[model samples]
Target: MMQQHGQHGQRDGVDAAELAAELAAELPADPVVPRVEAASVAVNLLWCVPGDVGGSEEYLVRQLLGLGEQASDFVPTLYVVKSFIETHPALAKLYPIEVANLTGVDRRRRVVAEHTWLRRRTQHAELVHHGGGTTPAVGTRPIVLTIHDLQYLTHPGYHSKLKLQYLRRTMPRSVHRASVIATPTDWVRRTVIEEFDVAPDRVVVVPHGVEADIGVEAPSEFELRSVYGLGSGRVIVFPAITHPHKGHEFLLDVMAQHWDDPDLRLVLLGGKGLADQRVAAKIAELHLERRVIRPGRVPSSHRDGLLQLAHAMVFPSEYEGFGAPVVEAMSLDTPVIAADQPAVSEVIGDAGLVLPRDPEAWADALDIVADQRVELIAAGRRRVTEFTAAKSGAALAEAYRLALS
Candidate 1:
């Protein structure tokens, strides 16, 4: 009996050792799973905007920074131009950064650098994400291109001939080369796929995100009136670059009608663009010099304050990839009077007044917005929750995964 017990104990010990050895062998075979958990996939982000300060540049900076803050599965190496680094000095402390000494204004040099220098530098990257409109013409790595809009093709009058030609030639090729195309709105997604003949599955719509709590102390009324010459009146802010497509002329026309009213002021925020000469001419034609205040490119910190101080925000653009101002104004609980376009309508969604492109209609809507301020503010605050960084970041991460797959 004692001998039988000993034999049983020996059998149990052998069986336990065999089970442990089998488990150890399985672990080595699946070493990738453990390493994947330890490290993230490295992606190259091409953020080469040098001179631009428009919504596209803002979107790229905010979204990339947001992704860098949130993404654990993928590590992004931001490749920026020297000017970008100069503009945003704090970026160095946040993420892995590389700078290319390229000028934003020199198209020829930019193209050469992209094809030769930028292309060669990104060889080891798992993928290249082009936040600026164009991608490297020659590259083996898969690309994810963000095309804000096809304004050059849609409204040729809005762009210079050279710019129009450059975009016409390069945009379609970029679309073809991209593994995935990311747009800010569904309207843009459909337009790009249809115009470029790209597969629908290759497109992803990631809307812009607004700050959850944008609380900026506004400059006192005295400061605004004394410094910027924003007169004592019911203020309507139009925050957009003075591009022809932005329909500043229409807003100026409306301002012309309101010129006689001493209590109405129109604050035009943003720097001048190619069509700014035309806009300046129209402002002169209307003799709205005093009634319209052109405080070109207010610092971003003051934007929310400006919006909060406004009685209403007007977006008169005829074309847009996304109406960022509309969302921004809404986030600040400011009433919006926007053009009745697809992108604007989609973003506003009955939260604010959407009127026809007619100046008379917009003028009338602005009047209504002033009266219904309380209701509009509440609606706008609620509407802005739909657009948040968490939502956009998740969609962007999924787009990267799709591109990699």
Candidate 2:
């Protein structure tokens, strides 16, 4: 099959890939693929926990681990753990149970660093982790560091002071020492260069790919409405819990200000963090109880269900590495109303409505998007289709080749 190439001469989209198909056709006739596979000599993996365990990290790690089966040319290893699991016991349960991952041991030469409220992983994991190692590295394959975002420095409101310190100290070391430093977007790539002074060539930006075709068992719109106990007005889905960076407060204000409109209903996907309490209170203060639905996390079986039932997706975040929910929503042909920032704009491209951060502004934009569903749906499908496990994983394999060569 053929692919789309941008003005920069990069393959921007995939065509039929007929040549690849021809080889696949030959695979059954002969057995040329097995003996041609190549294996690597040296490697080690370190999984950097970017956020409180969720979509992007899981999607990226799943893709990386799949590298072992997809590409016979190289053997890859992975380390997946957030830096705070040891000191912050409450947060350990948040780690992704869906993937095979390992965490670094924060060895801080001293125990004082590992106290609660003070968190501590190994020194590499400790001073760097703020203090704690959820698990030790399980393999010796070359380590690749995946820094999902550098939000703590750019958007401190998203996390606590202790979480911020761990990022400030350990992230840079991971970036510098990683055989290959991978991020999800170009915005993050630029952040690493400007913040840590790492050369651009050393960093690889591999955006998180959608996992829709992974056989998710999502329900239908009728099933979604029945399960959530809702009758359709217009469904508005936000795949975030109540995090400051997620703009949940802003979303509340936007919906509350327009409470008179009976045509819209807002839904939240995950559980709220400590800061989300105030936002929750604001919803009650506005008397939007019946209008809003906190159905908690939509299971993988129901992500598509939720998306299908929605009239539009409103992802007004203050910051993001690469919005995986936005991608998934779009992949399933749902309309999107995302943030109008540099990184998000780059990802959304010309697909959805990119509006200002103001609640009033977002509210108005949401109206426009709900009506322009066709355009929004088409753009979402187009842009999201660019990111696939095979595409990102193959690109990453190339990066690994360069790093270990």
Tell me the lDDT of candidate 1. Answer: 0.69
Residue lDDT tens for model 2, 1-405:
000000121121211133233223322232222211222322221233334444444545545543433544654212223442332332223222211122323222111111211121111210021101111222222445556666667666655455455455545655655556677789878988898888778778767775537435777778788888668677888887566677887888888775357757788887555557887788899888888888876566676778777877789887877777777778878777877867787788888888888776665775587578787787777787777766676766666665665
Total clashing pairs in model 2:
31
- lDDT digits (tens) for residues 1-405 of candidate 1: 000011111222222224344333322221111122222333333334533547776566666555655744776667766777777665566656666565444444444455555555566677778766666567656788877777766677755454555566667777888999999889989988899888999999978876555546566557766777776777889998777778899888877764357777888988776578999899888788878888888766566677877889999889988888898899887899988888879889989998888867765676688689899999998888877755666677878888989
Runs with alpha carbons beyond 4 Å of true place in candidate 1: 1-53, 217-222, 258-260
Residue 256 lDDT, candidate 2, scale 0-100: 74
Taken over the whole model, the C-alpha lDDT of each candidate is 0.69, 0.56
Weakest lDDT window of 10 consecutive positions for candidate 2: 1-10
